[model samples]
Target chain A: MTRWGMVIDLGRCIGCQACTVACKVENQSPVDAWYAPVVEYEVGRYPDAQMAYLPMLCNHCTDAPCIKACPSGALHRRDDGIVIADEEICIGARACMTACPYGALHLHEGRSGELLGDGTRNTPSILERYAHERHIEGTVSKCTYCAHRIDFGTEHGLTPGIDPEATPACVVTCPTECRVFGDLDDPDSPVSRYVVEHGPTGVLRPDARTGATTAYVGLP
Target chain B: MSAPVSALPQNVFMDRWALEPKTQRVWGVNHAGWFTLMGIGGGVFLLGRIFDITLEAGRVLGLPIVDVVSFVTIAIGGLILIADLGRPLQAWRAFRNVRVSIISWGAWADLVFLTFGGLLMLPDLTFGDSTPFSGLGWDSHATSGIGRVMLVLASIAAVVVMVYAGAVLARPRSIPYWHSVAIPIQFLASSLAMAMATLMLIVVLDGGDVTRSELLATAGLTAVLLVTIVVHLSTRTTAPGKKESIERLTRGSLRGTFLYAAVGAGTVLPIVLGLLALGFDGGAREVLAVLTLPLLVVGGFLLRLDTLRAGIYPPVVSLLEAAQR
Candidate 1:
């Protein structure tokens, strides 16, 4: 059982929003919607202050708070520790968002179709931008770790599926090679080795027992 | 206002109409007045507690004035809700399904928050010679336990409170606005905002106020407002009905509620006040803090009230109009 995790090196990060754009395109998220967001914090005062960007998405904790908070089991943490949302079953409660300390989850509007006055011939607009694909509202969304791509790591079994293409879009597109994604369980994995070489700070809510898989290392 | 003691006509339809509706018959006092008083009292108690927690961190032994007041306010609010109920004992019946009922969770959360408050006060009452607790008499262990329990229960109650508020307005099908994932976020955000506002109002009315907490209150209010805005903005792609409701909130007659209350007062005002206070002399900061407190509270109240009033109750509104036609 491979547990997936990502190591973000704040030292190498340049505060560019490439990861944000990459995650959006890879996930086909709405133009205005955010799956991976880069939040910039200005530290120190005036001239001494430098911008520190934290690119965030679902940490996919082993014991996810979002999953526990959802009254409707719309959010599920997969066996691989990738938290996924089932849009159809979601009641749009948004308890998950409140529970998420990182503020990674976003509530996407669910649309079945527009009901005409006569209640027929529904007009669809989700495809208006995407050209054919339709995404609904009333559903919460977050980074899914691109499970489909990771699942088919190879077209015909190339290199044991080890971090080859298993890295998330955000991880792959990081300009300064700040983000690292691989199986946390594999000691030789880049993410695992990075964590071992330089101890990283895991996400901690006030409760501090959520057990976040994603770690932020060498935050400047 | 008192109802006129007019005699009912003997005709069945006329007599039925003549009898005053249960809602309209004055309970000897004004309904709006009672609601206002209740709101004010509860608001004050809530604010006091928040100030105590934010400023002092609740580190010292014994109950803070805010904690005692908050517990009392909660109990009073619970009683009001029960009084409004048709079958008050059925309140217990609500607990039968804690899994599904937000109301049930709210009741339990209230119980937990209050119980913790009371238990903390117990050691003080035992006549221990501790400084803060010496007034009453709680032991150090008892105080710690009480604090820990209160902290956990308060966090849980916070969510339960929002859930109960949102559940009242939520309908998955119709009024698209209420159907969005932002329902709980809005409710939770508004509750915290109101809680902060209520605290500020009480501080304004009371003497010997702690000014340092004004900063913390502003910070808390600002954080919730930012989150609320994020949630509200995310609803643009919601169902047409919901989108229309959001339009009403942002651009229509209901825009005042969103603009003045949620945005201007709740968000911008608090941030500006906090920042302004940082630059001012003590005297000016004190005055500005006093001024901004009410604005924040009013903002919170207007936010909740507007959201409640503007909520589309769906087929009820349409069906009633159709029936009249």
Candidate 2:
């Protein structure tokens, strides 16, 4: 009955990349791995130059192509509408990487375990100790919408979108409060209300027919 | 009072209209190469088996070259596929999910094809006879019947293995170039063309006469390959991203590979050489056949590589541009 989604208000986003840093810290991802990245591009010519930023992450589509493409069934969708990849079962065929039009999925090449030229390692000891769920070598990884935080918050009688503790790190860290996360199916939810108020929100590659859950307002 | 400068609307719109660069493909030349070999090998064995059954051909000379090529290439392809995996050890899990995954079906099909193809070739290797159980003094008729059954099963599996390679790539809705219905059909036609070319080469080398039927088959398959390429290129895509991908193949960065290697050398050159071989005689014909075969084979591989390379992800900015349009 629950379909989790995100609404990004491009008009309000300053594109400081605070959310990107917060996501990396919260997830303890590898130096090369980015769970959320802000894609910045120059819009105009010299006299009228402008920069536009688009934050990219997994859309977690209702009809996920990655789930169908995974030969090992390592990628699956939960009942709550979150799509996840099981690292243990992943054979690293990179099928899902090709299947995703958004370019959200990434392969973790185990660079985190590599020794540096001076015999020092790049991955922090704290990350090694606490980020056990971080992707291992030869496995595919992607954003999970911070399901762990949501589940934990729900168990503790807190609402995910309303409570900072229950929300995704990127959503919580956004300075402009541009990111909205809530159940799309619930008419009363903030995400659904935002969509209704804004009148029109665009999903990436709607032509892909993947039924992307993430929507954006004022994308241009 | 001084005022802050801001970006113009036209500049913002232009930025939103710009197409993003192509994403890095996970399936690259290695995957393309192995899949092509597998399709060619499986197709040759299946067609050769069918020919032997219908034409009453016997095991001539010593080696069953067609069977050997079939089993070897498929085996090697299967190995390469496993090695290409990030976690090669977990490849066995491919069989766990067959309902939705073309890759899972491909793995199972490869297994069946190899097993049955190997079984069909057993009597030839062991007893030097066309019939299984002949060394044991069993009824030759019964052994032949069993061989036919095995050949039929192997051929079915071989066809599936060949098509499944294309199916796996085609099923991804993301890449418009590979998502077309023509892709699998094109792959199947190219596989058969490669198989026929290989067969022609082997026959010519072995001093066996290149039969007219085989030449016709090769020509027909080459024609199919050409038509499919045209269809694949001409087909209109609904999305701007897909249209951009098509442009990349027809006129953009991938044009050299698509036009020169895949279309020119692979399809057109082979067809010309095949036709010229039919016109020539003696050593001249053999030379033409030999030259023609490798071109077709290489072309097949290049076609796959071009398709893989041309797979452009849907542009993120296209969503914004669509509203303006």
Candidate 3:
């Protein structure tokens, strides 16, 4: 009966992209596909211009449009409220890609095996990377709320939001402590408490009726 | 709407605040080809069956030419669909979840149409129900009951194949321009028109007679397609990317493809030519039919192509507007 979610405090976000790098390092997503990139935009005219950052990731809605759009039943939700795309069943129709209001899902086309541009040799070769459930070719992927870590943590008697070993890499790596992660169903959880404290926390594409788990404070 | 600072390919994420629409890169020429072929195949099958069911005038002694065309196009379209997939080998997995997924519905529809459609054509063929049957069984090929039922099943599947191609696109709310009930109906109209035109050409080439109702069906479907185009053009909804979609089709980058090719040449020209051909008979009428049918058929393909290319996703910023709402 758990619903994992996150609440982002935009007021506290410094736009340093620490969480972005953390997500990339942890997830090792395909090339040009950032699972948790903080997209920055400028506000106001030149005289009062300032950068505003929006950290983008899968909202993991209760009524996920991607899951509904998928013809192959590749995308599914776990009992603990995590959305996952199973590589074995995925036919790569890309319908979920179009159905998603927020461009959270990414198509992995075996870019992990290829060498990076400019001969940087930054990332490890595909063979050297973690083989199990890492990157699957010709399948859609998105943020899984680090369910692997959560399951591991739960088995070992650790709290998700409080324990760095259990939480998502992005939440753990944020220097400003802008990202809060916990079970949304539990009122005592950090995420629920944060949302309760900050009344009217905003969600992206509320009109989509996605019942978005990710909420934001100081949206402007 | 805030103005963009850089002129990127619209789809690329940039430092823009405004909710500009970006063209979807998911479906391309391959998908367009798939949609076009499926529509044509389904249309031809449905039109031919209408004659069989309603007027009881469908060919029984020989393989119905229209059904063959339908089978071929659907086969080709199915291949194209597989080719268009990221994982082509696993394309069979797409047939699951027909209840919830429109794509699955389409896959099942195509499969059913192919299976039952091919089977239904067998008993009607001169050699189909004989040699192999006589050798295997005592040549009593009188399975009295299922002809009409099979025909109805195949016909329904054919209709789904034609309509679901549009429903697949229409089901996506990410693009407001395509998220309309009008799209499937328009596709249905366009598919039948294209099929009718193709049938007309076949009749002309084979020296078979052209029926008046066929021409009337063609004209009626074409008229419906024309009205749908007008509806598409006049859709100035405030649904994020709708304005940009309209602009793209009307006066923007996609204008040449949408306006000139899909509309002017494919749609309007055929109507004008068909109207003029009504004034003639004999060889003149035949020549006019030949010219007009090709346009209608080609127009059908272009309509699918241009529409697929015109699918613009409201820029990433559009989410903020929805968030605000």
Candidate 4:
């Protein structure tokens, strides 16, 4: 009964984009397909203006619209409440893209955008950096909550949020540790504790009622 | 909160952020193209059942002329859908989630419409008047009981194809403008009007007699379509006020396309022309049908394209809302 969830303390995020770099390195997403990126906006105007960073990713909702809107049955939520796409059979109709209120879904462009003819060169070039990406081309991609690390850690008797090995690449790489990932079902989990202490709201577009598992501690 | 006309609306704090509304790039002109083709094809096919206009028309390559047009148009639309897909080879997998997904439902409907509709026309192409059905005292394949059953099935499928295009857009709750029940009704009205107008033009150009009944139906449908568009545009302005989808369509960059082409040329122009034609008889009506019909078809396409292009995902952060906060 593990409902995996995340809580982001918006105040703690410094807009450094370490999570973006870590996600790219870990997931090897194509140039256009940013799995996790910090979106910043202005709070005030002119003389009183201030930049506000909001780390955005897949909320991994309880009643996920992307899963329901997927015409190819490519998107599915696991028993643990982690919504992952089966890229093997994705037809890439992009119905899920329109359905997601948060704009979480992204199409994985096949090309890695390396320098042309870099693959033919012998020296350490951009080709070496993107030669072995595991992502399937022309499939819809999103933040998977680092299911790979979580699965391995759980099997090895390690707690996800507490252990760096089990944690998501973005969560672990975060300099301020603003993002917290844990099982929502566990009453003693960090996410649940944060929910109790700060009462992080479910999602930005609450009217849609996606039942988003991810919550924000201080939504601007 | 007025709609920001420019792509970038002076977000000084962050260079790249969702400050103003953003148009959804996923389903744009490509989707509009496919939907328009399929919807018109289905609408024309369905309209033939209501009136004997298509049945009275001569055959092309041993198949009813309407059937040939419907089949080819739908097939071309199918090609467009495949072309839009990222993985075109695996397009068959689109039917894997028909239960929950409206897009899947549309795909299934398209299949049924093609299969049953194609089968209904097969005998005419194969054996003509002296086929197996002719031996059973039926002059044509369309005169048989099974043929009538197939027609019923195909018509149902065609109706679904016409409606499901709008339903697919409306299913995405993310886009506030599209998230409405009126969209499907408006689409049905618009498609039917365009379909009827196209049929009349074809009949007129081919030196066939123009009927008043056909003209009236087209006019009625066009009027309904106009009402739906007006009502839909005004009512859908509730989400986040100025930077909403409706605002983008009505007052933003898409204003010319929506107000002029879709509303003026597509709906109002046709209705006015239809009235002028209906007032007179003989050659004048035929000429008006010729003039108005093309406008309806092109306007229909523009209407769909503008509406689709106007789908603005509500601004992530509004300066006005932030100021109020």
User: Candidate 3 recovers what fraction of true contacts?
Assistant: 0.36
Model 2 CAPRI rating: acceptable
Candidate with the greatest TM-score versus the true structure: 4
B87-131 per-residue lDDT for model 1 (tens digits): 344455434335653545655765665565456554444324555
> For chain B alone, what TM-score does every candidate structure achieve against the true structure?
0.64, 0.84, 0.85, 0.88
Rate residue A193 of model 3 by lDDT: 88
Ranking by DockQ: 4, 3, 2, 1
Model 1 TM-score on a 0 to 1 scale: 0.43
Is candidate 1 or 4 superior in lDDT? Answer: 4
Tens digits of per-residue lDDT, candidate 4, B1-325, equal 4323232211111225655566677776788888888888998788866777667776775677887788888888889999888899999999999878888888898999999888887766645454443233222246777778888888998998889889877876777888888788888898899888878876876678778888888889999999988888777366662236676677778888888888998899999988788887778989998887778878888888987787767754445766555
Report, for every candidate in turn, its global Cα lDDT versus the true structure. Answer: 0.54, 0.77, 0.76, 0.78
Residue-level lDDT of model 3, residues B1-325, one tens digit each, is 3333221211233223324466776777888788888888988878765644212333434556767788889999999998878788999888887768889988999889898787766645566555332222211122344656667778899899999978988876777788888788878888888887777777776675566566667777888899988987687556667777888888898888788988899888877766666777767766776786778767888888888877877765544543443
Q: Pick the candidate with the highest lDDT.
A: 4
Query: Estimated TM-score per prediction?
Result: 0.43, 0.87, 0.89, 0.91
**lDDT for predicted candidate 3 compared with the true structure:** 0.76
- Candidate 1 Cα outliers beyond 4 Å, as residue runs: A1-220, B1-63, B125-147, B162-164, B167-174, B194-217, B230-234, B313-325
Worst 10 residues of 4 chain A by lDDT: A115-124
DockQ top scorer: 4
DockQ for all models: 0.01, 0.35, 0.39, 0.41
Write down the worst ten-residue block by lDDT for model 3 chain B.
B133-142
Better of 2 and 4 by TM-score: 4
Winner of 1 and 3 under TM-score: 3
